[model samples]
Target: MAADDGVVLDEGAVVLEDAPPSNLDKLENSPPSNLDKFLKRFRALNPHFVRDDAEKLVCFFGDSDISHWKELPRVRITGDEGASWARCVNVGVGGAEMLHVAFYSAECRAKYRPDVVVLCAGENDLGAGAAPPTVFSYLEKSIAAFGHLDDATEQAQLRLRHDPQRTRDNANVVSSLPIDDTKSQQQDGMNASEFSRLRNNNTDEKVPIVYLCTKPEPVADAELRREYERYDGRIKELFQRYNSSCQEELLYFIDNSDLRDPSLYAQDGLHLSRQGYQVWDARVRDAVERVLLKMDERVLAP
Candidate 1:
């Protein structure tokens, strides 16, 4: 157990002594970054900026449910096969809780510059005996890490971006803009035109985060599932509040159907089976399609 740091969080939130250290030096040895290894592998896979038809990145992160999903790029983006499509990577760690995601939230965005991020965690947090309060704290931290903008400020930025005076001379600011899709995107070896697309004045996009609610699992009994459901509701309510603050149209959820369908689970009654992954993959791809397609419409619209 971690020693108390002598602090408490919000009403439902609690601070853990063993939580990932915020200091740069203490972090050299203490709690190790689990995502660091995985990110290295991903960066190596994508040696250079993807100038291929795959123009956008859609990242998926979570526990085994997300880690196990191995989807390829089959979803087409437009009539022109030459147009850019979505590239995806699953940065899930098998036993990760929302704490891991919260701690590494900024790095997650920096690495991929993903246009869309689908997050499916917290199941293991509940499974590992974390109470609803703990999960809420985890979620609050994760959402805040994304730098959620106040509605008024966000709207003001959007309005300003759309204003003719501001957008009419994108060429002028293009040379001066510090960051957009990401500082890393430019650093990743993309040229000037590539960086400019990220600042596309049309969407005012902010790498929307998609929230995937914890699904009912057969490994958990009815009572446990009920507890999971209750926790899910609370965490989802929290997610929606944060998601609502800065979200585009992105919801192709699996909880829409009978959640306990055994066909979805493998023989282990926990990890998803081939059929289950198919269902999840399709829904995720559909969500990605909607977001990208909408952005296309927004850009093309008069």
Candidate 2:
């Protein structure tokens, strides 16, 4: 069994702020009423369907894992509790791959300008027999979509607004300090808060991509070990490379790979159970807080 507190990290904003209103209410107060109404109506009319940006603009992409996450709406909101939030619209299709995430165009990011993007994949890529180079190549293309310059016209409107005096100890800095460079390595020292600021702030840098890493699962079978060895290892390596390439640019990774519970799996020793989801949720909350803190430090820095 993984430690009882395996999911708990040393520093993170655990106390969630009041949950934001449903996406429907947010849309009620926005422009292009007709478009918003159409989206709301469509989601309301269909079962097992999800929608995005009813209030704020945000985009999410992955495969089945992310796609299913939409079904579980957040009861408690983490990160910058009161700042601003966006309803995630999963572009994930079950059994999708990294290449799918890269090759498949996400109109939402272009249209809504999300404050953050949650990317989860690779399992499917390995299942599909993707080579190591192919996997890394896909990630390279995907990250590049965020633009590759400190000052780019396409990403000029991004901003990192923060009220420094509000927090007691500038919680942002506390959350963003590098943890383990070897374990969660990346280019530059950009932590969670920095990524959040880049996404929310008015800057010329491309949209900050938060690379969410999958947790380590129990691999009792040789086949499972082989699968994990190829896909999981490649994903981590590729993320490190991306981080190194964009050290000064706006790019970062969130290591949730440490949030798994070995005992939560079934006899097959693969996949997360309900309890496992709880563990993953905690890590997600931490990443959100880190992003907020990074953004706050950048905006309020003296």
What lDDT score goes with residue 227 in model 1? 46
Candidate 2 residue-wise lDDT, 253-291, digit = tens: 555444446666544344456666566566655554455
Best by lDDT: 1
User: Candidate 2: which stretches are off by over 4 Å?
Assistant: 1-58, 70-86, 105-108, 148-205, 214-220, 223-227, 230-250, 256-263, 266-270, 299-302
- Model 1 / residue 277 / CA error / Å: 0.5
TM-score of each: 0.61, 0.53
Where does the lowest 10-residue lDDT sum fall in candidate 2? 9-18
Q: Model 1: per-residue lDDT, tens digit, 97-162? A: 665666666677676667777877766555555554445456545544444433222211110111
lDDT of 2 at 123: 53
